[model samples]
Target: MADYHSPTVIQPTIPSADMTALERLILGHIFDTEADGDGLYLFAEIGPSDSFELPVRDLRRAIAASADTESTVNAYISERIAALTDDDTHVEIDLSGMSWEFILQDIVRRSPTLDHVTAISAFTCTRMRPDGFGGMAVVITADAIRGKSTNDIVEDFLGDDAHDALYAGTHVLLRVREHAVKEQIAEAIGADPDLTSINPDAVTESDIRSACLDVVACSDLSEEQGAAEFRAAVAAIRAAERRDQAPG
Candidate 1:
C-alpha cells in the first residue's frame, strides 16, 4: 500500500460542459487581457468548448465571485449571454487544493467588500469536489492552513460552505500528514521512514487516537475535546481513504 496518509494531489477541473454560462463568463472576463491564458478567450463563442487556461489570480477571483447567490450569478451571466450567438459555448477551469490559503488571504486583502469570514466560506466551497461516492470532499492540501488567526483548522471545518453542506457531508483531505505531525507519528508508531509507513487498513483505533494526540497537543482544546475533534478529522480522512482503496 502507498502512504495511506501521505498528501496526494488530485487536480480538479470543471469542464466547459460542466460549467454554467455564468462561470465561463467570469473566467473569460478575468483572462481576457492575458496573452498566455492558455486557450482562455474574451468571448465564449471563439473559445474552445473543451479546455482553457485559468491563471491563479483569476481562478481566485472566480472562486470569490461564486459565493454569491445562484440567481445573482445567473443574472450576471444572462446579461452577458446575449453577446454569444452559439448556444453550445463552454469552458473548463482546472484547480487543485494547493495555494488556496494564500489566495484566500489575498482575496481578503484586495476585496474590501469581502471579509475573512466570507472569503473563508468561499474557500470551503471552491475546495470541495464530489467524492465519487455521492458525497463531497474538501481538498485541503498539506500546506493549506485552515484558519488565518486560529490554530484549530479541522474544528472550523465543521462550519458550512457558502450556502449549506450541499451534499451528504463534507470531509477534509488530511491523508497527507503535516511534516511535523508525520515525523512525530512515525516515531510514535514505530513505522518506516518512508511515509507509506503503515497499512491504513491495519491501523487501529489506539493508533489513530495516539496520532491525533500528537496533532492537537498545542490546541486550546481540553484533552477530551481535542480527542473528539481529532477523531472527527480522522473519521473523515478514513472515509476518503476507504474510497480510494476500494477495489475496482
Candidate 2:
C-alpha cells in the first residue's frame, strides 16, 4: 500500500507541516452533514451498530486522518448515514432536523470520542486529538459550531423541535435554582429571630438584595405573607454576604 503521509520520488504525499491544510479539505463535508437540516449527522455519529456498539469515536478519527481522500471521506459519510438509518425503525433520525441539542447529547453520552477545536471556525472541525476529559470537554471550545441551540436564526428556522432538547435542560435548571433559593431563604429566617417577624421576605434588612422567591411560590400558597417573608429573608442573607466582602 502506498503511504500518503510520506511520498516516494514517484508519488507525492502530504507533508506533516501541511497536515492541518489537509484537514481543511474535508471540513466542508463535515459541517455540511449537519447544515443539511437532518439528524443524519448526529445519529450516525452516536448511534449503535449491529451489535449495539457505538464506534463513532474511532470512525471519526479514521475519516479525519490526513491519509483519507475527499472521495473516500464522502463515501464514509454516506455509508454512516445509511448504516445508522437503514432500518425503518430508525426513522426518528430523519425527523430530528439537524438539532444541536442532539449533537450535544451525543457528545455528552459517547465515551471514547475526542473533540479537537480550532481558531478555525467552529463549523470546521480539524485534526482529531487522542485526549480530552470526555465529550463535553471536547466541545468546550466549540461554541461557535453550535446549531439551533445557540444560533438564533437556525433555532427560529428549525422551529419547536429545535428547542425541545435545549429547553429540557433549562427546565431542570430552573427547578434546581428554585429549590436552592427557597432553602437559602429558610435558613436565614431560622437563624435570625428578628428577621422572622417579617411576614414578607421581600422586605429589606437594611436596603439591599434582590427578590428571590415568595412563599406563594412554594408549597405554602395559603401564606400570602410568606412570599414577602421569603424574599426579605433572601435579601437579608445576601446583604450579609456583601457586607462581609466589602473592604473596611
- Using TM-score as the measure, the top candidate is 2
Provide backbone clash counts, one per model. 5, 11
Q: Flag regions of model 1 displaced more than 4 Å.
A: 1-24, 30-33, 37-178, 184-248
For model 2, residues 59-106, the per-residue Cα lDDT tens digits are 344455633433323343445445553233321122122432333332
Q: Which residue pairs collide, candidate 1? A: 3-196, 5-175, 6-176, 7-176, 16-91
Tell me the RMSD of model 1 versus the true structure: 22.5
For candidate 2, give the lDDT of residue 19. 25
In the range 102-206, model 1's lDDT, one tens digit per residue, is: 432333333334333211221112223432112112333222233342224434565545325575454443343445554565476565556665654355444
- The candidate 2 region of ten consecutive residues with least summed lDDT is 3-12
Q: What are the Cα lDDT values of the candidates?
A: 0.39, 0.36
Error of 2 at 44 (Å): 20
